[model samples]
Target: MSIRALVYGDVDLNTVDGSAVWAQSMTRCLAAAGCEVTLLLKTRVGNERLTAPLDGAPGVTLRRPYEESLLDDLGPRGLTPEQAVALITRLDSERRFDLVVLRGRRTAAVAAHTDALAGRLWTCVTDVPQTATGLTSAVVSELTDIAVASRLLLCPTEELRGFLESSVPAACGKSVLFPPVVVPPPEGAVGPGTPRTPLRIVYTGGFAPRWNTLEMTGLPAALGRRGVPAELHVIGDGIHRDPAEWAKRMGRALEDTPDLVRHGGRPHEEALRLAAQCDVGLSWRAPEADTDLELAAKVPEFGALGLPVVLNRTPMHEELLGPDYPLYAGEDLDSVADALVLATDPQTYRSAAQRCADASGRFTLERAVERLRGHLRLALPPAPGGVAPERPLKVVIAGHDLTFFTGLAEHLMALPGLEVRLDEWEALHTHDQYRSRELAAWADVVVCEWCGPNALFYARHKRAGQRLLVRLHRFELHTEWPRKLDIEKVDAIVCTSPYYADLTRERAGWPADRVAVLPNWVDVDQLDRPKLPGAQHTLGMIGIAPSRKRIDRGLDVLAELRRRDPRYTLAVKTKQPWDYWWVWNRPEEREYYERAYRRIQRSELLADGVVFDPYGPDVAVWLRRVGFVLSTSDDESFHLAPAECAASGGIPAVLAWPGADTIYSRRWIHEDTGAMADAIHSIVTEGRFDAVRAAARDEIAAKYSLRRVRGLWTDLIISGGFPEPVRPDGTVPAIR
Candidate 1:
């Protein structure tokens, strides 16, 4: 059954304001996750861009019953909390929604009367409005009731969560993280090239007093005195303050530089693009004004563009980016200028860019959807009678590499309401299966990890009413496995990313609907740990024996980095290439490895800087000694090594291999060995190794956690109905 949900917001869906954007994003995430969602707004919106998500979305609906203006609604003329509760109650009866999400203070007020919808109600407090007359008893009572009535309170930042929980005791245990959701930068959207002169700097967002708006005008001139030629580009105008005064002040302060550009204000997208072209981001909020803000949304916006930010140091900044971030500014203009000068040094800028770009991935629509699903899963009530099942879902997992699928099976087994069965097939030479026929006959669902003989065996032997699932990781596509596996008997084909799914459809001519993209599981919680200090100078690579892995490119990157700093070294946690049985037997494979091995030995830098370690038992312990992990693969369905390293707080430098951009933000993706070398230097010299490591860990923890991917597997195999296979004429059958 599809989940049904309703979202309430006090803004028009047509407007491009914070409330509208948040509502649209929340609803869009719900819809994408197979939820039948209805968005209820206080006023009708007319902007086409704001309403675009609802236009073609399946299982999504929008409504605006109030004709009243926004200004009047905030005054005495608006509907009261009781009135909102009654109206929403009536809508719930009509729509039969499974959950109701109330956004903002007004909606939170109405939550008190939503007892009939008890476990179904969730409230989000975007910000606490300061009344002109200050807080009163009536307002306090309403705020407290909001915490008491809602099943969960969603806070966008840790500071906000701390504030809300402290203010109302009832909110302490229930608050969940729901930070701002950023639209990912377009694929292949890169920053302006290196070797740019007169370092370009950009400042975006409103010139609100709290942002310390007027202080930025002197930055370019201050940097100029320090022998650094710089240009300041102001991309936005004053808001919540006098615009005329702002323009007058900026003109006076920047009068010395004829090249200064004050763009006034452009559309958000246009401004973002302009900012992306600049070299650095400036954001300095006054110390006095930094009272309640947990995070600044503009930070992620600039980070998405690969621009390092120069912002005032605060508890929030320290928490988000570690305390050791080098670009943190002080209250004075000189402090801000000094930070900017240090940040624009070609190498310094490169490291900051990688960290900022990598950190931005945690604030995307995909992460938002993952968080939404987790909250919804918990908010859902137990089934009536709470009775245990007679028999659990008997699952048979057949795979050559139990090393890869063992974690997934264990996670599935841990979930309540499901009893799992596992089956490990032998390598071709051994040809042994422990009661494999009995296992297949006894199982309700059978999963094969790779498109090898096990998948073919299940495809040929799967009984009627039994489900067969095959996951085709990288390497499986190029082999003959796709042709051998019979598609007629397979219930589903899982690819790690959409890129590989398309490749399978093109190469194997399999039905598109039969394939689903689900990333491999990474135990992120286990990888989060404190790293050794020496790890900063070490670069690590997992598999280098295969030609497709492009180990030559990795060596080139190592040689380039060693040119800049001799402290840098490359660590290879892999088996010797000659040990592989296929190497000498295959002339092409032997030639590639032998040539690359000779080059490594002949080069002074590689011979002295590179160290090889054979395969080990604990990857987590192995990652502790490595600060930066490199992925120079020519192709991959989904490379799990970099993710493991990142989860272990190691910075990952992935080459722009075929579909790598889909999995990693473009900042960490290097186009060549020169760029990779510059980035590695930038990270270590600027002392941002710890910050980047923390960011990588946070990203992995959010996207690929064991619990999160386990839930997806559960839904795909048991709960959610499977999409019917697509036909050659571009037609699809209804989902089962």
Candidate 2:
């Protein structure tokens, strides 16, 4: 029997934006999987202009809110809490839904009102608790109450499951790890031929700050310097400025190098087509943004297109690219140039591209949709409101912050049904305690954060009834953390990106089924901005550490810029004297700190104009003043600094490091210090800084908005089997 499901979110199904594309792909996947899927979108004012069909997928229907005030109703202007409850009641009375899947906080609340039909309700939660607002809070509370009172719950990643398990007691027994549905490649897509004319390098995304378009343009210019035939095609709308103006500015910068091509923005199909024409795909992420989950969708798209990728050596990339992939680049231009040279060779890159294509098949939308369908089948039987015998649910949390533990404790305290506690314990001078065995005994579940070094050891000691879950960040592979973690004993591991999850599972000796990928969350309301001009010239960096953060690397770029023009003043937020020692061991700390301190002291001596803000007190003010933000991390999980800088309307100058490339495209970096200096000069002297900042902010607000992430989290969590209800009926849920 086929299941009928209702999916609701704020994505524009007609557009080519990431969220819209995801929604469209999901709709297609669900339809292809033989599920009757109706998508309910919050009607926006200009939505009529975007009335494209939902890709003509079978078993799919698209609907808008009845009153046209759904967005307002979700916020302060529309429905009051009591009115919302009444409206939800009225709506459910009209339609008999066998299953209702909530996408975000607002939609989740609507699902919650159907508690009487709790046997049929499923809530999908995406990000951490930090992203939602009072409205989201209300919806989450309702969903939590329903999960506690209902039959089934789904979590996308173990990270989210841990969060839900701690936030709502009803989630303890029902939760399961279900990653997002992977979209399939279009049919008949073939790999590109050898670099025939110009070595066409394509970057298919918006010209956002995170895209680091200026830095990207500089690479082609750098190639021009080396006398290599290279051209860059940027195929997306201007996230910050008018497409024409952005093209004009970028075009002028590359006028001396005839090989460079700035194709500006194109429609989704057109962009993909353009990308197909290229020999290489350049994708990257901001190392500091902590939002690398966005890249999960793009990586498959690149592979499906059959383009060899010049990726940043992030853990996600390392996981996704496999061993046969091309070389990993650091922050230096020579490193990127070396990678570029290798990638330009058809013999070297073609096989790797094929490998990427092969890998992409594993994550195709059809497979993901089928996986989700099976999970739903297992989840649907018990129904929402049914009650069954209760048993002690064993859970294990591997690694995380103290606040996370406290949060979990608070959530468990609210629910009296299941007992929960931490499973392992270690004391670190940095955070007070590293791990605790006492906490492990108390925990029915074990939760762990895959910080570094200790993940494998903790994974090895799992006992029966205790499921081991390792939450991964970007730094897992770059450091020795993966080496130390025991993968065989881990019941499940969660990642923010599928690329990362797949990689972690591959390396850790864990079953493929044991890994789950979920997106991270951010506070949307706090990301609000006051209208300001984008021409600010001040540059900012918000991280404190040196080694992987590559603080010295950023200073080098700045120093190069200053050598050309003494007026180039850069601002940095450095590590506190005490925190500097925490990143490395005593011996490594001494070596790294001495080098970093000397570099900082030397930069200060060389450029008295450079300013250092150790305490980040003026971050807000500096954010407004800065035209650019720099990220030079040698390694990273997801850097929050660059994202925050872009959100504050600053253009980003990112080091083309490994983990960061997975988040942003490589087109954002210069191949060398000279190129970096030149790009900086162009931005400052050519008045392009305004456009960069404008594009940066728009991209963050629209594409990486906390709201979009929240929706993704909801989908992943619900699809993963968290908050599933127990029923008297003899129905078993599918685990794969």
Candidate 3:
């Protein structure tokens, strides 16, 4: 299928300028590359002349705000950059464009910062801080902001790309080279003749002083001194940077110079024709031209006209013409003169022009088409062969609480061709049977988040050819839910850790091949927030339900720490036993929580130290005040509190439950409450809490990153197959 593209440039195509010409080339080339393009145009006056080439071009369609009467509605600055973004939104809503190419910095910046478009942007930013020192704190920040808005940062020259990626960290790896294109000559245009006397040299483009246009007239005098009289013709009307001064300077330079002829601006075709008539072309620019990271558009245009050009001897020019090309010239009159005199030599002239011809070949329309196709390919990569069908696999994820798997769900939903449906059970044991059965029949795969009644129901009632997967956490493993599951019908059992997988296999009598481990995804970026002052004194515990979470042990650690440092406090962020009707009904569970509360109130240190924060989805925020997260359970499938704490830039003081070391580092685990107190005190006294936090954060990020885990889940859901088994140490293998 052809790629659908939305192209926008904040340029007026009615004029014959570089930006205008670039827009024209871009629109034509995108169509050539097989894209069904909607080129949103911003035209001043009229664009009939400029857009003539694209009038009947297949695969190219034009949309102008002026023609749409949006210009009349929005008033001046016709098709403003922000309006461009709005137009993109409107068109995208009508029919999604697979790719978006943004050329103007203002439009790109607005789109990027607004997040109106996310990773779909293929942004081309020509102007940015160039020098290392020029990238001040503010400039770096600005560049970083824009960097996130684009999937690729398009550069016309490798030198510029290298500079940007090296200086601005945000640009690294995202920068790509898309060289300046040479617009193909008009059909049936004239070609250059053999070398002639009174060597005719032409310079065409904007009369920017930076381009050194005024200095070219002196080349005739310099060439004459060398006994080679040269006729210098200059074409262009536009002026940049102090236009009045440039006009005055250029007028004085051109007046009464018999060898010099200045022609006002004309169409691009006329300029090319004039260039072909000349013996050689001039692209010389000022000493301080912004050429370090940019290439002169006219340089290749001169080459396309089969005319050897003299320009600033920069790296980009050297890359185009070999470093030893005979026509290399500096901006000064003598250097250009010296090169013009050399062009008088037939052997030198033909060789330089031949090099020009060869260099221009790289920028031909066909090559540009291929490069652009490659860029689009990289931007939107296809799924692995045979793994992802053109039609998305219908996946239904059923669970009471989808909080744990939300990231994975979102990832699957965003995937190119993966349809994800959720069967949210009212409770672990209950759901609308009719809806559940209907979803089971429709889904290619049904994933039960917990091995509860949902898994058993799906295993028993799943339609033929539909794969069923069940995730087993700690609580569900102890229940009879696993024994009831139809092991033969179940495709795979997902365990968060290796120890739990072993337990699931042993207790449920499920075969090893049927069980696979995919750990929980931690939203690290969300959790990694700055901590409040005195956060080191606060100990945090997420849950203490039915007393198995060992909130008493957390209070014990706090009590012991406060004996040495009274600043240390225990903050239990959990739902009280009374809040849960099931746990409250258990006499032992009620007694356990009552006893833990009595101990916290009775003990002198823990009385003032222990404070219970309400449980909610705002754990990341609550962790800001928590320096050390405590997990004192007797056993765990995979206690996520400590890993999440580590992710939130806090050290975890965990009691070494059985198999705990497999998932958490030994440095974080202690044999008892006394050892836990000692570790926390030492970190506090030595001011090593920051170092410990960094280390723990790194470890958690490497292990439980949402991006990696989401990918594993995607593989499992898409392929209806298990990923590699978890190692004995709880480490998952990289997806192959």
> How far does residue 557 in candidate 3 sit from its true spot (Å)?
50
Q: Give the Å shift of residue 400 in candidate 2.
A: 32
- After TM-score superposition, the amount by which residue 145's alpha carbon in candidate 1 deviates from its true location, in angstroms, is 1.2
Clashes of 2: 98
Best by lDDT: 3
lDDT of 3 by residue, 342-441 (tens): 8878888888888988888878888888888876755654553344556877889999988677667756665667678999999977789899989888
Better candidate by TM-score, 1 or 3? 3
Pairs in clash, predicted candidate 3? none
Q: What's the residue-level lDDT of 84 in candidate 3?
A: 84
| Sliding window of 10 residues with minimal summed lDDT for model 1 | 723-732
Count clashing residue pairs per candidate. Answer: 1, 98, 0
- Every model's TM-score: 0.48, 0.44, 0.58
- The models' CA-based lDDT, in order, is 0.72, 0.55, 0.79
Question: Where does candidate 3 stray beyond 4 Å?
Answer: 73-78, 187-194, 241-243, 251-257, 381-391, 394-415, 419-717, 720-736
The better candidate by TM-score, 2 or 3, is 3
lDDT of 2 by residue, 1-736 (tens): 5667665544444334555555555566667767788776544323332234462456876654444554334642334434444544455577655566554555455546555655565665653353224226555566566675444455543345544654555565455544544444345555565554567777765555455555676676677677777887766543545556766675455455455676654445556767788877776544443324324455567778887777667644665677547756655555666677787777887776887787677567767777666655444422222111264343444444543234333333223233445433344212213345545555545557655534554555456665555567765656666666666665556666445665676666567776765434322223323323332445567764645565566667777766667656677766654574556556765676577667756764344756776553334434545666777766555565666677766666767654455544344455655676677678778877768666666655554445444333223222333212111131222222
Report the lDDT tens digits of candidate 1 across residue range 1-736: 6888998776545434455567777888888767998876665444445566575689888755554332334433334555556667878887688878887687667666567776567887775743323336666677778777776778787656655554555564467778888766555445663426688878775565567766776666788889888888876543453566775665565454554677755544556677777888877888774555556677776788777888877767766666777789888889988888778667777777777777778788788888888766655523312224565677788877776776577556644556677667668323355477788788888988888988887777789999998988877888888987789888889987667788889999999878877777777754654575589889999977668888898899888888888888888998777777876578898889888889989998888888887675446656768988899987777788888898888988988888877677666788887888899889899989888888777776666677666656776777545533223232323435
Candidate 2 Cα errors over 4 Å, as ranges? 44-56, 65-91, 105-124, 129-184, 211-214, 238-270, 290-295, 331-337, 382-736
